[model samples]
Target chain A: MNALNRKKEETFKPLGSKSLLSRMAKYRFLYLILAPALILVLVFCYLPMFGLVIAFQDYDIIGGITASEFVGFDNFVKIFTMPKFTKAIINTVKYSSVQLFLGLPFPIMLALLFNELRMIRFKRIVQTISYLPYFLSWISVVGMFSAFFALDGTYNTFMATIVGESYEAKNILTDAENFLGILFWTNIWKNIGWNSIIFLAAITGIDPTLYEAAMVDGCNRFKQVLYITIPCLLPTIAIIFIMNTASLVTLNFEQVFGFQNIYIQEETEVINTLVYRQGILNAEYSLSTAFGMFQGAVSFALVCITNFIVKRVSGVGIW
Target chain B: MKKSFGEKLFDVFLIVFMVLMCVIMIYPYLNQLAISLNDGTDTMLGGITVFPRKWTWSNYDTIFSNESLIRSTVVTVITVICSTILTLIVCVGAAYAIKKKDLPFRNAIIWILLLPSYISAGVIPTFILFRYLHLMNNILVYILPSAFTFYNVIIIRTFLSSLPVALEEAAYIEGANEMQILYKVILPLCKPVLATVALWTMVASWNDWTTTLYYVNEPSLFKLQYIIQQIIKQSEVVQKMVNDSALTGGSTSVRARPTSESVKAAAIIFSTLPIICTYPFLQKYFVKGVAIGAVKD
Candidate 1:
């Protein structure tokens, strides 16, 4: 692949030296093909970026971005001092840290378990079932979970029966203590199969000859996996870990919103939801945009820092 | 190789574990289906686990009869089809253009396109932009913003770059222009990847309620998922009322009406049905597409 890229680069060097006008004329068709997407990106993506200037302004719907009064850093200062914003920041960190620590390993273990299954047909069927949840929208997943875990729902009824009628039914969805646990478990259930695909692909890429050699050396299946499979999976694992770590602040808005209720809003609120509430619902556009900008900056920093550290430590980074 | 006692025990454990995992994954949908099919009033009495106790189609009938739900369904269908077709055209065209390695300023253009995936301009700015563009409360809100994602562009570009350049060259030599080669030769070969992306866009547009929540204020413009979300919220309130009434020995008038819980379940199932029905046949292509996407070049 590197050689192919290098060869293409060599061939394109002369084209690169051509005059700008000549090159433009020569590749007019390609440029024309690219125009629609370029224009859309400019209007939607880049234009909104220019609208980020409203974060520094006291933005109102009437005056809009251009006419809004520039407040300099007042919005940022207000968000920093707000209690709700602080609570949201704390909750975001707590939930995502839990997710990062617990959520990262399950997929790797699932991939290993999947690889160990000798019956190809059973493995395929199980995989199909596992991947089913990933396709469902967060609305459906949260709705289904809410029904199952409602006070008069299936889970509570089954629990009551099992405990011989003394057990009290709990609405786990609404309970603050149990909300994070529900999020963690449901996230795992939805993503484990889909997430394991890369690791499984990596395992498949491992040389069969190494396994054959391990067998000749009388290594057990467990030992072979521990020594060979895990080692072979390190680079892919490192890359995924870095990516996950970088996005630690950005929780899935739809999932959190679907499960959110007045009873547990304090515990469930995150930056994304906070932005929606303040900006859209409360109409505090400048403050919300500042909050969002802060979140984006922190996430960007995390990505760079993690990528740098991983590159230094293991010579594997997203770059 | 003959299995030892421990290995055989391990096999049994693995099989049982896999079966249990499958059950856990599948049980929620089946439970919802049961609740949706059951008589709404009876469903509130609980213990309708895997099968409906008092079977009835009233829940679905109610959903189909509701004017707003029917409207939302139509809106969602139109949005999905329009968005998917638009995304395919724009992304495929950009991917084809980017596939030309010698295209001037290729690296700069690619970076410009890909930057948005990493850093968004946040919702408020985007909302303001939409207001300025006159896209607020418009159906085009769903179709326009999603037309260009660099991830899809890269995926299609990767697929295109992998194909033998010989076919395109042959077509070019036969007096076919670039657009003709792309339409005639390239598109025919890209069906699998295109299907994968189209399915992705379809599911995304269909499931998106946030666009409605954030952008459109007109109730007439509500999409299916947003309607379901509203139903879920309303049902929660009603459930609370039912619980409160039972505690206070109040009138069972709330109970007389078909329970909103059942209706909520039915609405959810109705909205999810299209994806569920089509996924089995298309799952392989998606799996392969995701694998290609994960290992970025």
Candidate 2:
């Protein structure tokens, strides 16, 4: 009996371990398909993250990652001491907060206003035209703005006709005082049309019977919007608001970078521009990496807090 | 419901406001068109509103006449096509793998891929790494960096996961392999999301100029948007030169009346025309795509 049991155990030994291996082997081709993307993410995305440790070191180009001496928090100290870095942080916060406070409601308002339109053809036309600018590259938009705002350009001519004073046209883009306003309003202009899309979808999704009941109760269009439409739109609005708040620390690098020039650099410079200048132009690897890590930490905290508040309040969140 | 006087007045006000908004939206492009078609010298006289004051194709002629424009256009075409196709393949494959529930290390792979979207290594580390790899000035710079847009992958994954699992189950029962079930059963059902991803990839690749602004110093590899940007910058510089010379009363010997204005306008139109034309069709999918992408878990 003992000899027979020993022969059975020996026979089953290879099959026991090989079964798990075989299950994974069955999905081998799928993994093969995913190999290229995995490699790209590792090389392009994950490797740079490992490279992020250079933020702590006194990163040197000639010595590379291995030979760089450890500096602890020196890079962060340097970043905090640099006046330009502080200005960039302040500007970024200022621009983002203004955009959050002022620019958040325009799209929803636009969506509601458009929904009130009875003429379908005209509504479609308005939507099409509104969406057109969203497709234009920032370079193109900045170019157009620069040309129109030139001293001898059409804007000045039109102003001359209206005000009858041929004072030189204001270079609004370069004016330090108008920088935040310009950024906010142009963002609204470019995105309001596109941003209203989800709101429109939400509006359409609301039951028509709610409006019918409101009408039976003698509610005017304005009252209907206030009582019915806004309440129904709040969930969508809450989600969007929370999502946007999460991104409040980050600016669109291309949008600001394309519009930037030496004249307006002081007013328009933000964290991204700072990173670009220090990292690419000056090759201050450790300092710029530290700055990026700082921005990332702040942004991550903001997103987490917003997500928590939103989840608790509205029962919907980014997660 | 019968309309009240207030309702009628409100409708009128709304219509007027919408019409005004449309005009504001369209006038910029139309203004550029008018300036581009007008004689470059005449455009300097100002007030070319919706239509050209003096019509000519010379601005477009000048832009097309440049050899760099043609080369850039060709380069743009090659990059957009190659990059879009490559991105779609990479994203779709990974998204497919991620859809499988029992795949080994699936959660970890997902976390790694999605990490970059949230936390960046900043410009310095990425630049140094890419330079080390010698990807600068190479066409791979455009294609490889964007090979996996994790956002698009998430969108596609959400779509694939939402699909009924029974279809794939039946295929598996019928002795189909994983690849077969994916290509034959799953892919056919992924049209809407696929279209959305494709259009997005195409638009992004076509519009990108920052890659060139950062890495490409070789004129031969200049993309269309980047070259157009250079033209706009040159025109601005020459415009400044012309303005300065005129101010100094130095008898500015200008060549061809500084046709830079109309040329820049023409370049704007040239670059944006294709996107404008393609927008209406893709608009159908994007509205739904964005909503689904945002609201889904």
Tens-place lDDT per residue, model 1, A98-173, is 9988899999999999999999999999998888899898989988998999877989999998997789888877
DockQ of each: 0.72, 0.58
Q: Give me the TM-scores for chain A across all models, comma-separated.
A: 0.93, 0.90
lDDT of 1 by residue, B123-239 (tens): 998987898889999999999899888888978998998899999999989999888999999999999889889988988898899999999989898999998888887776445
Scoring model 2 with DockQ, what do you get?
0.58
Q: TM-score for each prediction?
A: 0.93, 0.91
lDDT of 2 by residue, B227-275 (tens): 7778766667435533443455432233334367777888888998999
Candidate 2: Cα lDDT at B215: 76
Residue pairs in collision within model 1: none
Q: What is the interface RMSD of candidate 1, in Å?
A: 1.0
> If you superpose only chain B onto the true chain B, what TM-score does each candidate give?
0.92, 0.91
Give the lDDT of residue B195 in candidate 2: 89
Error of 1 at A307 (Å): 0.7
